[model samples]
Target: MNCEQIRELLAGYQDGELDGAQHEMVSGHLEECADCRAELAQLDKVKEVTGKVKYNDLPLEVWEGYWQGIYRRIERGLGWIFASVGAVIMLITGAYYLVKDYFMDPAVALFPKIGVGALIIGGGFLLVSVGRERIFAHNRDRYKEVQR
Candidate 1:
């Protein structure tokens, strides 16, 4: 057998899975080929190290608690989302009324009105800047789909 064929059969040979004829063919090739022998030796080392490794399995109670923790996080996240939306709506409504009242009052100075307008414009610019930054960051983020 050629080097490629012998290499392919090396795994099965190491595991003693080959029949009499195939076994003899791979054995003869290994005797003559130093490179294939080296490769087989490397494969044997890998198998030996991996065979000694052990994995720990979690108990059922730990798994149940893990799922419960996830559920609680989801529930809290939804609650916070609702609370934030409500708070933002209330704040916007209050700001609108305050601005409207200021504009309607005869005693209010022109400079204060102008200042409020400038503040609103500045807030708009800040919001847009933050949005653009978030979009750019999202595009560049390598682990965008990876969960927390």
Candidate 2:
């Protein structure tokens, strides 16, 4: 067999997978061809090197670092949730008192109540707009995951 044909059969020959005739043919070609012998030698070296490789777990510090990052994210998320809840409760209570003590009182002028209502509505819209813009920008930011 030629070098190409023998090269193709070299792996099967190495593994003893070829039938007797093909094995002998490749063996004869390998014996005569220096290039084929070198090719087979390289293949053997690669197989040996890869076969000796073993998997090992990462160090304890590595695992700890990963868990710490996860825990920090969870803590910050919970803190934000609690802070937002507290702010909402405070806003609702303040609005209730303002309406009960001033808006519902007959002594308060009409213009002042209208001004306060407009201020509250305007502030709420601005807050919602800023929040939506932040969320939109966050969603569109391409470099969010890139650390400096």
Candidate 3:
């Protein structure tokens, strides 16, 4: 097996999840690859230490307090998100009216100039949004492949 495939299977091999043949293959690879052997040794040490560590249970009041803090943070985060969305809506609405007024004014000789400026700004925003979406999609695809 290749080094990457061996690395990916290391966790399963350590956990005894691999079939006998696959386990043997990984073992063979580890015997030949110093880096993989080092990685496996490190993982084994981590697992051993973690397994030996003791966990403490929180008191009822402490649990409640922990949950309360989490709840408060979530509430604050949601409130901020809503407020940001409202602000964006207001800005867009106000800008729409301003643009409309600029274009409707009969004596304004700079209507075309203002319209062109608005168009350029709007186009730039659209391009940025599209670019961001494409980048997010590409990264998401890569993440899924890695998970597999």
TM-score of each model, in listed order: 0.42, 0.53, 0.36
Cα lDDT of model 2 by residue, 1-148, tens digit: 6788888998998889999999989988888899999999998998787765522244666778778978986997798699889999999999999989989999999999999999999999999999899768855662564352
Question: Compared with the true structure, what per-residue lDDT tens digits does model 3 show for residues 10-51?
Answer: 989999999999999999999999999998999999888776
Task: Give candidate 1's whole-model lDDT.
Answer: 0.83
The pairs that clash in candidate 3 are none
Q: Which stretches of candidate 2 lie over 4 Å from their true place?
A: 1-58, 137-143, 146-148
Candidate closer to the true structure by lDDT (higher is better), 1 or 2? 2
The parts of candidate 3 lying over 4 Å away from their true place are 54-148
Error of 2 at 137 (Å): 4.7
Expressed as tens digits, the lDDT of each residue in 24-69 for candidate 1 is: 9988988888999999999999888776552223466667878887
